[model samples]
Target: MHRSAPRLSRILACAAVPVMLVAVGCSSDSGSDGKKNAGSSSSGTASSKPSEPTVEPAKFTDLPDPCTSIGKKTIEDLVPEAKKKGGTAGGSTDLSVRGSCSWNGLDDQGVKGSQYHWMDVGFTRFDSDQALGSGAKRATEDYGKQVTKTKATEGAKKAAAEPAAGIGEEATLVTYGLSKTDEDFVYATVVARTGNVVVTLTYNGAGYAGAKTPSSGDIVKGAQKAIKEAIASVEKTAGADASSPAKDDAKTDAEDTKKDDADAKGDAGSEDSPKSKATPKS
Candidate 1:
């Protein structure tokens, strides 16, 4: 009987060893699964962040040249004249406006893509001289004042000055461009009054890549004619009277006329005059 008890105890011990090994193996597999789940969760969070917005370039179908659309007697026609005065005309494109144009080209600065020319012409009979004069004066004075203020704020000993000939009455022109390193070059001119009306033109240009540097003088020489032509185009369409009402003014005038007509009709209806009312079923 004692020998039988000893054999039974050995058999029980052997069975207990396999159960202990299985528990350890299961624990290791659970740990590995937990790590895989954590890695997946981290990857999901990274993909949820937003990106910055980008400005898309302008696009349009090919159309007639901007200069060609200008009337023969218009200031835009004077582009050839201005070119005769030693100015360069760049490539011209339509800006989608019925009578507007955008001209782009190089100036004497030898800087490519340095010019953006825009022109608008209005065919209405309103005089644009006053409006042109006002806009040009405002632009010139405002530009100077802004530059002066900026210099003062920066604690400069003296402000940079501009030439008297730089300001004019027939055009309000602005030029700005960026260098390769993103430096800014900005300029503007205003021509407020012209022979038959007002002309306003603006120019803006920048160089993105080049070993050669562009001077302010080069920029001016290259862009001045384009700017003048744009303003001339504007003047020809809108005329020289700069002080004329805005485009929206026409809508206001139409509304007023409608109200006047309604009131007049009301007054005529209130009258007892037989002539004011048709005889009912005469």
Candidate 2:
């Protein structure tokens, strides 16, 4: 009976060995499948990673020289007898980003009194930034700010602003009166934006001695004429491929401005007798 018991025990032990091997094989397969799944999950996560957002490229990487932006003839017409026919460059640390030129003069008319003229053009260029936005979009925002600031000039009187067409992608003309040097001055400022650049031109004139202050319409016309040239200069700095509708607009504006000036020659008050009341300033 003892011998029979020992043999049966041996058979049971052999059966248990097969069961253990089967369990180990199943566990090995499960572990291999788990490792493969983990690898696949990691690969999928890497492959599905999101990409960074992109921004529009900036246009007109550089700016035109503000001093020479206007032609000599234009300067002569705007500031007759100008002390410096070549406009004076305003202080600028970085000409690439921002620049300005100013011209001022007093034309003596003997018994008719002296006429004072002052004009300045400024350019500001913006670069595209992924965080901020496109260059043109940034310039548009700055265009609105500049218009608002011009309208809120200190001691301004009868300040008014209106959209100016055929100047740039967008433009605004702000006219106002300011009392300075014991005389009233008429001022017209044109704020325009083209691509990534902003062009601001301010033209103001006052009568010295007995001369009549310039009329608002004439001043506006002069400002628009000058700014159109200044804005076009930006495209010149840009490569030839950068040509845009702004150029055509400027050409049309120039023709119209010239005709308008000829029609209002006598009414300008600077050349002939005082006709209309003087307009407002800076």
Candidate 3:
């Protein structure tokens, strides 16, 4: 039997149609699966969000000038021949948030002896952040850290920590000794947190040549005094006067005295006045 060419061509085309349809079906299935995966990924991504904790409001918003935070007299006492009496400011990207200053010098006494001294002060201010905590709380935490850091300094000896009074809301003084330049150096670091600001003051000194080594008590006292001034500066930046604490104490004392006077007067009047009508004097 002889088959016609046209019929042969139609038979081949008919066979190709099923193959093309199957390929299309397979492609459609792949596309559908891709769409499903994309949708699932998008859904999961949209549902993922990190949770945050509730925190209290911050206290202070600005920091003081680190170089001027401490008094000039204090610097002179700490560093007798400081190269820069105003102190050298530390690097800071945000001046209102954090700042530091340092002074180091060697006092030459011409045949008597030479002494070396170093004083540094830093101010860290925290702002209220929703994800973190209140500025005051954050400052307090950092204050503790500074104290610990001073106590755990490498090569430190005779390290001790004690509460610092009359400086701020919370404060600690860490005292330690380290050997340098073939001489023993005494160090005192004051870590204080007031409101939302934290103040860290470190003072260390050593006798050079043949001078006497600085006393720990003196270093501690000087650091405390410097810290007090720094605390006042922190308050000043927030628009509080330097004499605020003293003023508050005076006002409180006056009020208490007035109250006592009133009470005393009342008592005296009661003594003179009888509950019932006083009988004729006998």
Model 3 TM-score? 0.65
Give residue 153's error in model 3 in angstroms.
Answer: 0.5
lDDT tens per residue, model 3, 1-282: 357988999999999999999999999999999999999999999999898766766556677888988888888887898998988999999988889999999999888799898989998888777867777777878887888888899999988888988989989888889998689999998888898888888998998778899888888888888889988888878533244588989999999999999998787768457753466897
Prediction 1 global C-alpha lDDT: 0.42
lDDT of 1 by residue, 12-65 (tens): 999999999999999999999999999999899977778644422112112223
The top-ranked prediction according to lDDT is 2
Which pairs of residues have clashing backbones in candidate 3?
A: none
**Model 2: how far residue 148 lies from native, Å:** 0.9
Q: After superposition, how far is residue 12 of candidate 1 from its true place, in Å?
A: 2.9
lDDT of 2 by residue, 1-282 (tens): 989999999999999998999999999999999999999999998899677788888887898999999888998988999998987999999999999999999999999899999999999999989999988999999999999999999999999999999998999999999999899999999999999999999999999999998898889889999999998888888532354689979988999999898878755655445545565676
> On TM-score, who's better, 2 or 3?
2
What are the models' TM-scores? 0.32, 0.74, 0.65
RMSD of each: 18.0, 16.0, 12.4
Q: lDDT of each structure?
A: 0.42, 0.91, 0.86
Give the distance in Å from residue 109's predicted Cα in candidate 3 to where it truly belongs.
1.7
Ranking by lDDT: 2, 3, 1
